[model samples]
Target: MVSPMLSMNQATIKHADLRQTLDTLTQTGYHSVGLWREPVEAIGVPEAVRMVSDSGLCVSSMCRGGFFTMPEGPERRAAIDDNRRLIEETSAFGCTVLVLVVGGLPQGSKDLAEARSRVAEALAELEADALAAGVTLAIEPLHPMYCTDRACVSTLDEALDIAAPFNPKAVGVVVDTFHVFWDPNVLRSIARAGREGRIAAYQVCDYRTPLEADPLLSRHYPGEGVIDFKALTQAVAATGWHGDIECEIFNRAVWDTPFDEVSRHVADAFDKYVAPYWPAE
Candidate 1:
C-alpha cells in the first residue's frame, strides 16, 4: 500500500525554532509542516514565509484563526479582524487551509446553543474575506470536554452544519482523531464530510486513556494509546481525502523530546499504524 503524504504539525515540537524544525522535517522526509500562528507571528510573517519557502516544504495548514464566541463588542470585533489577518498570513505561507477553533461559551454564559450560534454568525462574517484570500476556513471541532472553554463546536456533524451555508471552497471541516475518535457518530460524520466536499484537513493524534489533569496535553503519538489508528485512518481514506495527514501531538513528554527524535518516532508511528491503510499505488 502507498503511504499517505505525512506532515508534522509545529505543536508536536513547539519548542523548536522554525529553522531547526524545518531542517529536522526535511531530514526526516516529511512532505509538509503545519505552521502555527504564534510562532509564525513571533518570527514576523515575511521571515516565516522565506524560511518555509527556502526549506522546500509544503505547508499542510495553519493553526489557527477562530475564537468568535465572545459577545458582540470589542472582543468579538477584534477576533474577526484577527481572523482576516490570519487569512492573509495563511496565504503568505502558501498554505491553502486555515484551521479554526471557534470559541466556546462567552464569559459568564452557560448557553451552548447561543455560543454555537455566535460561531455560525462569525463564520458568515468571515466567509467573504476567506474567499478573497483564497484560503479555506477549516473549522476544527474540539473534543466535547473543551466545549465550555475552547470550542463549542465539538463534533464533525456540527462543523459540517456550520459550513453548509457557505461555499465549500471558502469553508470546510477539520477531522482530528484525538478530538473526534470518541464520538459514536464519527464514521458517519466523516463520510458526510467527504460526500459534501468539506474535508479540508485530517490531523492524527492518539488519545491516552486516564485523562490528564489538563486534558489539553493528553494527545499521544499514533501507536502509544487506545485509539485504533488503522480503523480511523481507513475511514478517513474512504472519503478519498487527498490532503496531507498531519501528526499533531500535544503531550508534555513529546514537547520535551528532541525534535529529531520526535520526528523519527512520528515517522515510525505513522508507518506502523497508518501507512498500511493507504491506497496501493
Candidate 2:
C-alpha cells in the first residue's frame, strides 16, 4: 500500500497532462497530488478540479506562481497580475498554499541584493491578495546554482527573512530537501521555521553529483543520492506539522520513463527513504 502521508507532485512526470498525472498517481495508490499550472491551465481549472475530484486525491499547492524580481516596470506589474490569477486558480483547487519561486537577477544586472529586494517588494504587493484569497504564498528557495537565473532565494533562512514581514498565513516558505540538504544551518533553519509556524510545504527529492548539463534536472529519487531524508523528515515532524509529504522529482531520466513506471519508482523510493521517517499517526 502507498503511504497515506505521500503525495506525488505532478512535476515528476513533466510530460504528462492533467489527466495522465492524476491517473499515474492513483494507479500507484498515492493519496494526493501536487499540481503544476501549465497542465492545470491546459485542461482549464473547472475540468482539472473535476478530474482531481474524480481521482479522489487530495490536491497540494500549485507548482509555482512567483517571478517578480524585476525592478518596478511593466514586466513586474505583469508578473504580479499573473500571480494574482494563479492565486485564484489555487483557491479554485481548494488548496491553502500557492508556491512562489522568487525570481533571480534580471539580465544585465550585477547587483543580486537589489534583485532580492524586488522579491520582497513583490511579496508586499501580493500579500493582501493572497490573504483575501485564503491562500498562502509558499516561497521556494532553489539551490545557489540557480540564484542567477531561476531563484534568488537559495536558502530557507533567506526565504524566511523575506517572508518575515508578511503575515505567516499569507506568506510562507517551502523546505525542499534537494535545495536545502547542502546547507550547514539547515537543521537550525527547519527548527526556526517550525517555531515561526512558517513551513508552507515539505518536499522530498535526492541530489547527486555530476549534475545534468541543465542542473535543474539533477534531482533524483529519494535514497538514490546522498541526502539524509531521515534527519530532515524527523526535524519537520518535530514541529507537529503533519501534512502530506510531496515527492517532487525533476530528473530527465525519471521524466523520460513511462508514467506508470515512474509512479511506481516514486512510491518505492518514498516508502523506503521518507515514509519510515514520517511521524506515525
Candidate 3:
C-alpha cells in the first residue's frame, strides 16, 4: 500500500488570502486539505469548491460543525440542522469526514457531564443524516484544558465510547496529537480505535512545556516537542489505514506568520517527522 500523504488544515494558514492559500498548498506539493467553516462561508461554498477542485487539491475533512453541548431549544436544533447542511456541503466537495469538536460550556452552565450529554443527544439525531450524505462525522476529543469551553469529550477513550453505537465507517474519532498525548491511556485507546475500526482521522503536532503559560502557543510542529510521535504513528498504522496524515495546529504565533510560509512549514515538518514511519515494502 502507498504511504499516507500529508494534508494542510486551512486554519493553520487562515490569515492569508483564501485563493492564495489554496495556491500555496498546491505549489508546496500538498494535495489534501482540512478546511474551517468560516472561510467557506466567507468565500461561498460553490466558489471554494471550484477553487479546490480546479487546483487539484482534495479536501480530507471539513474543520467543524458540532457544538451541540450548549443549551437545548431552537439553538440546539439549529446546531444540528447546520451540521446537516455541513454534511451536504461535504458531499458537494466530495470530502469524507466532518470533524466534530463536540463543544464546551453553554452560557452560564458549568456542568461537564451535562455538556457531554448534549453532545450525545446531538450525535444520535445527526448520525443518520451523515450516513445518508456518505459523510463520516469524526468526533475530535479536544484536550482537557479545552474541556470547559471547547469540548467535553477530551480523551480518545471517551470519544470511542460516544462513537460506539454508530457504524464505525459512518461516525468515528479524530485522533489529534495535541489532545491525546497527555492521556496515559492513549496507546490503549488508539489500539482500540484500530481494533474497533474507528480511527476516521489521525493528526500529529508536538506538545509544549509549562503546558499552560500560553495555551494557544503550546502546539509544536512534529518532532519539536515531547510527544512520542513514532510510537503514535505506529499505533495508527496498525489499523491498516490509508489516508491523509493531517497537520492540525492551532498556535497563535504560527498563525501570525505568513500563510504561505506556514503551509510550506507544515508540509516540511510532516515529511521530516511522520514520513519515515510509513511502511516500507
Candidate 4:
C-alpha cells in the first residue's frame, strides 16, 4: 500500500488543471496535494475550492508567493499585496502553508545582499496578515544554480535565517530536496527548522548532475538521481513533524506523460527511496 503520508504536488502534473490534478491524485492512491497559485487562479478560487473539497484530497500547501527581489517601489508594493491575497486563497482551501520561492536578483541590479534584505522586509510586511489568516509563509530556498534568476535564498540555513525574526506560525521554511539536498549543512538545518518550529513543508525530488538546459525542470523521481532520500526522510521524521510529504517534480518530460502513469511512477519511486525511512504512523 502507498503510504498515506504521500502528497502529489500539482507541479508534478503541470499540464493538468485543478480537476485533473485532483482526480488523477485520488485515483492513483494519493491522499493529498501541494497546490500552485496559477492553476487555482485559472479556474477561480471559489470554483477551485468546491472541486478540491469534493475530491477528498488534503491540501498540503499553496506553491508560491514571493518575488520581492525588486527594490522598494510600486512593483515591490504590489508583490506584497498579491501575497496577502494568495494567503487568503490558501486559507480558503483550509491549508495553512504557502511556499515561497523568494526571487533572485533584480534586473540591472547585482547586489545579492540587498535583494535578500528586501525579502526579509517583505516578510515583515506580510507577517501580520499571515498571522491573522492563520497561515504560514513557507520560504523555499532553491539550489544555487537558480540564484541568478529564481530564488536568491539558496540554502536551508538562509531560509531559516530569513524566517527567524517572525513567529514560526506566521513564517517558516519549506524543506524541498530538489533545492536543499545539495546543502552539506542541510541535515543540521532541517533539525534546526524543526527545533525552531519553522518546518512548514517537506517536498521531495531528486537532482542529477547533467542538468537539463532549463535547469528548473531537472527534478526527477526519488532514487533516480543522486539524492539520499533515506537520510533526509529519517532526519525529517526524527524532528517529530508528521506533515504530508509532497513529491514535487518539475521535469517537462514528466509533464507530458499521462497523469496516471506519472503518478504511478512517483508512488513507486517514493516507496523505494522514501517510505521505508519514514517512521510508522
Q: Estimate each model's TM-score.
A: 0.97, 0.98, 0.94, 0.98
lDDT values for all models: 0.90, 0.91, 0.84, 0.91
**What are the RMSDs of all candidates, in order?**
1.5, 0.9, 2.2, 0.9
Off by over 4 Å in 4: none
Candidate 2: list runs displaced more than 4 Å.
none
Question: Which residue pairs of candidate 4 clash?
Answer: none
Report the poorest 10 consecutive residues by lDDT, candidate 4. Answer: 1-10
- For model 2, give the RMSD to the true fold: 0.9
What is candidate 2's TM-score against the reference? 0.98
Which candidate do you rate higher for TM-score, 3 or 4?
Answer: 4
How much is the lDDT of residue 176 in candidate 4?
87
Alpha carbon deviation, residue 280, candidate 1 (Å): 2.3
**What is the TM-score of candidate 3?**
0.94
Give lDDT tens digits, candidate 1, residues 204-247. 98987797788999999998888877777888899888889999
Q: How many steric overlaps are in each model, in order?
A: 0, 0, 0, 0
Q: Which residues of candidate 3, in runs, are more than 4 Å off?
A: 1-4, 211-214
Worst 10 residues of 1 by lDDT: 1-10
Query: Which candidate model has the greater lDDT, 2 or 3?
Result: 2
Cα lDDT over the full model 1: 0.90
Q: Give per-residue lDDT, candidate 1, residue 212.
A: 78
Model 2 residue 184 CA deviation in Å: 0.5
lDDT of 3 by residue, 1-281 (tens): 11248887877776765687788888777878888878887889999899888988888889898888878789888998999999899888999889998888998987988888878888889888888989989999988888887798999999999889888877899999888987999999999998998888888788978764668567877877888888888888877877888887777778888776787778777777888777763
